[model samples]
Target: MSKILVLGAAGKIARHAIHQFLGQEGVILTLYLRKSGRLQKLAGDSVEVIEGDVTDTRHLQEVARGQDVVYANLAGDNIEEQAKSVVEALEAAGVGRLIWISTLGIYDEVPGAFGRWNHEMLDDGYLEPYSAAAKVIESSKLDYTIVRPAWLTDKDEVDYELTQKGEPFKGTEVSRQSVADLVVKLAQDPTRDVRASVGINKPGTDGDKPSWY
Candidate 1:
C-alpha cells in the first residue's frame, strides 16, 4: 500500500484529487490542512486529516514522515517558505517522490493576449516566491514532477493536453478536474518518470496549443 500526503488539502484542485483517490486500492491518503475545521467535509473513517501550517518545520516533518509520495497543492504569498519547509521535512524523512502544483505563467509559458493579461494580473511579488520554491524542489534528490497548469477553470471536463519540459505551453485554460486526473495518473504510473517540469492545458482552445501536435 502506498501512503500519500496531500498538502493544501482544502484547495479547489485538491478536492478533485481527493475524489480521484477514493476507492483506489493500496492507497492510504493523509490530507494536510492549516485548519481541520475547513476540511470537515473531507473527513471519513478512511481519510486522515492533519492540521498544521506548512511553514512550520516540526509540523511538516510530523505530517510528511512515513509517506511514500507528497502532493503539494499549496498557493499563497508564503508559498516559497512553505515549499522549503516541505522539502526539508521530506528530505529528513527520506521520502522520494514529490508532485508539485504550480501555475502556468510561472515559466513565461502563457502566450498571446490572454497571456499578457495573466502577466499583468498575476506576475508580481507572488511569482518570485513561487520561483524560489520551484528551485528548491528541482535541486532536491527526490524523484519529482512539477506540473504547471494553465489558467484554471471550475469546469468538470477532463479534456486537456500534457506537454513535456522545454515544450511551449499549450491552451488558454484547463479544468481543475483535468489537473487532478493527471496527478492521479502520475501517482499510478511510476514508469512515466516525468522528472522535468511540464505544462498542461486544454486543446483547441483560443490562445493555446493543441495537446497533440
Candidate 2:
C-alpha cells in the first residue's frame, strides 16, 4: 500500500486531495494537523487523523515515519519556519518524497501587467515568506516537487495545464480542484517531477489579472 502523510491536512486543498486519495486503491493516508477533531469523521480503514503541529519537528518525524509520500499544504506568515521544520522532520524520518503547495510569482516568472498586479497583491507579507519557504524545500536533499499554483478560485472544474520552473506562468487563475488533482497525481507517482517546481493554471484564463479581480 502507498502510505502517505499529509501535513496541514485540514487545509481546503488538502481536504480535496484527501478525498481523491481515498478514491484510489492501495492508498492509506495519515492526516496531520493542529486539530485532529476537525477531521475525526474521516478517520477509518483508509484514513488516520492526528493532531500535531508541523513546527514540532520531532513529533512530525514520528508521524512521517514509514510514509511513502509527504504532501504539505501550508501557508502563513511563518511559512519559512514551517518549511524548515518539515524538511528537518522528513530527513530525520528518512522519507524522501515531498509535494509542496506554493503560489505563483515566487520566481517572478509571471509576466507583463498581470505579473505586476500579482506582486502588488501578494508583496505585502505573503510572497516574501513563501519564496523563502520554497528555497528551503529546494535546498533540501529530499525529492521534492514544488507546485506553484496560479490565483486560485472556488470553481469546481478541473481544467488545467502546467509550466515548469523558468517558464513563464500561464493563465491568471485555476480552480482549487485542479490543484488538488495535481497533488494527487504527484503523490501517486513519486518519480514524476522530482526536484522540479511546476506552475499550474487553467488554459485560456490568461489575463492582466484573474477574472474575479
lDDT agreement of model 1 with the native? 0.82
Error of 2 at 12 (Å): 0.9
lDDT of 1 at 81: 82
Candidate 1 on 46-139: residue-level lDDT in tens?
Answer: 6799888888888788878888889999999888888888888888888888899987777776667767777776777866777788888888
Error of 2 at 128 (Å): 0.4
Give the alpha-carbon lDDT of every model: 0.82, 0.95
Rate residue 122 of model 2 by lDDT: 93
Q: Which residue window of length 10 is worst by lDDT in model 1?
A: 204-213
